[model samples]
Target: MPRSPSLRLSVLPLLVSCLVASGALAREAGDTGLRLLHPFATPTPPGAPNGAAYIDITAGEEDVSLVGASSSVSEVVEIHDMSMEDGVMRMRRLERLDVAAGETLMMRPGGGEHLMLIGLEQSLQVGDRFPITLEFAERDSVTLEVQVREAGEEGQAAGQHGH
Candidate 1:
């Protein structure tokens, strides 16, 4: 059946509006509304080794970034992200990782961005925690105790935040 042009035009506007609204909703979900994700169990090494830290940091009411990281464990600490180039996976250093306001940024091995620990005095095992200092442009310096887990993730992404 042939449809009228005016009828299609009217529906077009509604469809466009619906798509725009949907995008906004997705962004809102990604953003921190009134709460934030707090970092937990941030593990680092003493000397130097190829390792990483997996944690979930709560974002404040304002947007921020996980700019840089440091620890007594490693001589060098850097915020890094894992990406693939030409199907080859590579770990790249980042100036900062964005944290949406009132949202949580998951720094895991197999997802998103994470901290890469280079050169370790000793390798980390499960049931271990160490001190990790975080530096955010907006937030002041915060020292946190990070727990180490087995190869795979072991802790639930937990934190507390309110407006």
Candidate 2:
């Protein structure tokens, strides 16, 4: 028996949705309702002491706080923020970053909130992968892989979103 054309078309959308979801940078943090999206770090120069990483964090029913992060590539990972004040760029170390309920904290390069990988044990090259564990205040910790990519690389594919 041949399937109806309408049925085939309906299934095609579903299939496409699944494929897109699979490629999207959406990863839930345990049962805490925290989603980490598109975590990536830019390649570092040789013997560079520091590097930065960015990600998009979405909160669920309740607010969430990101206290700190840890990775083997760096000796210390600090939650930091970069902003322009008085026509000059300034960077500050944050003890914790808060994300409101049903809101997102989008960390990007060049400005805003970012993860500072200090005292790097090695220079991060393009295509290198590593794991970074995030600790949240009063919430379970989540470990996610970070992908190394060049600056301005908007990740939307499966491999670009990391492991």
Candidate 3:
């Protein structure tokens, strides 16, 4: 028998918190078959208009589409993709991102995909923590705590591309 979704969702935060308190580097959460892992954001300079966050998402028994997100740290949150087109870097907003069953969607700094925090309410300093809610299509949304780390710390590459 598998754990119930509600039960898992309820306990995930405590589990993740304990792990982090024990010196674990990453944070994670999930409900049903979808798991969110290693959510972190970069520190922002004073008066910066925007910031960015990255996370890795793993799909379990079913496919999941990440449709949107919200956070108190910013006025708006957007899903964005950065890629090279004709030798020029381009960033585009995405309506939704799909992760197939058993696949993982990895978001990182300086390239690929990320969450854009537009109209930042305040500068994100290192060690700052906040909540960001991720909405999935036809599934329950989950709010995960995001930790602020300096770029390049915790194995994440450092770059402010597309910011």
- TM-score of every candidate: 0.64, 0.78, 0.78
Q: What is the full ranking by lDDT, best candidate first?
A: 3, 2, 1
How much does candidate 1 score in TM-score?
0.64
RMSD of 2: 9.5
- Candidate 2 lDDT, tens digit per residue, 2-31? 878777655654543453345444665544
RMSD of 1: 15.7
lDDT of 3 by residue, 10-65 (tens): 78777756755554434444545677876789999999999999888888888889
In the range 1-163, model 1's lDDT, one tens digit per residue, is 8878778655654553453344221111122342222333334454436667755666657787777888876677788878887888888889988877767676655645777767765776666566666777775544555567643444333322220
Clashes of each: 21, 0, 0
Residue 84 of model 3, lDDT score = 96
The global C-alpha lDDT for each of the candidates, from Candidate 1 onward, is 0.58, 0.81, 0.82
How far out, in Å, is residue 162 in model 1?
A: 15
Better of 1 and 2 by TM-score: 2
